[model samples]
Target: MAEKIPAGGTDHPGRGDWPVIPDEREADLIGLDLLDHADGPDLVLFLAGNQFMAVPELLEAFRAAHPKVRRIFCETLPPRLELRQILSGGAWFRGRLVTVVPDCWATVSEAGVAALAEAGRTERGQCRAYLRNRVVCLVRAGNPKGVAEVADLARADVVVSQPSPVHEDIAEHILAMYRAAGGEALAARIMEEKREAGTTLLTTVHHRETPERLLAGTADAGPVWATEAAHAAALGLPLEAVEFGEGLDQRGRVRYFLCPVRGGAHPENGRAFMDFVRSPEGRAIYAKYGFLPV
Candidate 1:
């Protein structure tokens, strides 16, 4: 039997500390995807997954400015999956069907925005780029593997945590950076040869998981958005970045595009949120989390 240790290791009770909020629902699924007002949201947003860290700040400010919008449901999944969800009419979650259509959607890929326009779900001209980001090699603090640049990821000793091109939109961009650094051969070596060799770890969500991989010693390094590395550092995680710089980092190419869904439930709410996103306040919030401004 395991002995139970007192709270705080000394049974030191503090004011308003010991409590458990009772659950009234039969099944309360837990996840951060559903933010602010969970049920009956007036405005819904489907955002690119890597931008998950910025959602809270964006929401708080949005609420402060537009107090009437009490419920705002935002889902932060990979942009591709989010697009598919929007196109498919609905998606299943926890054995339940969630058919809530997003009023607004954002993606790092123009193709994703183009797809929606092609489907006639959103008007083509409304989609616009709002933010920019670039790739970097995320490494543990001190960079024990001594990875200096994007090309260094191909070194025999560096185990790279690469995002899967199939799931994450950022993966192909990172591969492009590899191509810039050491040409197509280097890109093939990292994604093909080393991937088959089990040294290139493919992550479903690079921004969220690469830090975990680096800290847990599962990966020596990873190619992730520079903002992701900065966001991880801000969280007090033992992580840092080996910057790919302007040429290799895909500076102009890595633009974040946004649009309001044409036939969404709340077009007014979506337009208001889009204003906030491109506003000075929105840019500041994203910059606070290390995103590059458009």
Candidate 2:
């Protein structure tokens, strides 16, 4: 079983503080102890799900800048629901004050930001966008099926793997774009023809997993992040990414944010972290990973 760390303990040097440093041997017990130090009103950033791939370096950078930050807990949830929780002040994680920062695709209009300010809520503007990714058809080493576009997904023998629309918002957005681009009818036709239509294609693979699966011959085609695909190509994944002419809109890219909860314990610390995130140094790190500075 996985080791469980309890919440709320006295502050001391520990392993959890270094999220970027991978543990090669045993689980870092010191790090877990540090998490217990975070208590009441302390800043707890709840990242909108789907941005996990780029978190390691960002966390490392933040920790380097702000050592006083007692604990940094990264949690993930659906974007829409996370937004509602922030707006409604719902209880999350043992009633500790929480701030919601949606992934990149979630865009808050200027009006929404202004409204948040008028309501006397602190706007940290910590969330930053880094990379843009698109769904692609990943095939084995060679073009066996001759798959080219979204329309080709209708081929009787073609096996396509996709993530569930309910959990994978990106997949849903991709499907929406595909339909808007006139591929809807074709998609329906494919489903009707293939009685063994597989929703299992919608497995919980991450952006990196798609490429890995394709290279391993586990999947013929799967959705993958463009940056991950680029990195995978560099690593020689025997895969090719077939881009659909009409792709998901710019809104599909994931964004990261740093927000201060209304009643947070460490408002000052949260603000400091947010400011650092936007500073030249922070922007440099984000840019390194293909993130755009806000």
lDDT of each: 0.76, 0.49
Best by lDDT: 1
Write candidate 2's Cα lDDT for 123-239 as tens digits. Answer: 536333433444556676676778777666666566666644433345555556556555668546544444266422544423334555565665567655444455556667676
Clashing pairs in 1: none
Poorest 10 consecutive residues by lDDT, candidate 1: 20-29
For 1-294, candidate 1 gives per-residue lDDT tens digits of 011234454342331232211122112212224432335677888888788788878888999999999677777766776676678665444323455678999888877778899999998798878899988888999989898877788987889888878657898698788888889999999999998998998875335677888889999998888878888888898888887678888887999989888768889999999899999999999998888888
lDDT for model 1 comes to 0.76
Per-residue error for 272 in candidate 1, Å, reads 0.7
Model 1: per-residue Cα lDDT at residue 21: 13
Model 2 poorest ten-residue lDDT run? 20-29
* Candidate 2 local lDDT, residue 230: 54
Total backbone clashes of candidate 1, pairs 3 or more residues apart or in separate chains: 0
Please report how far candidate 2 places residue 123 from its true position, in Å. 7.8
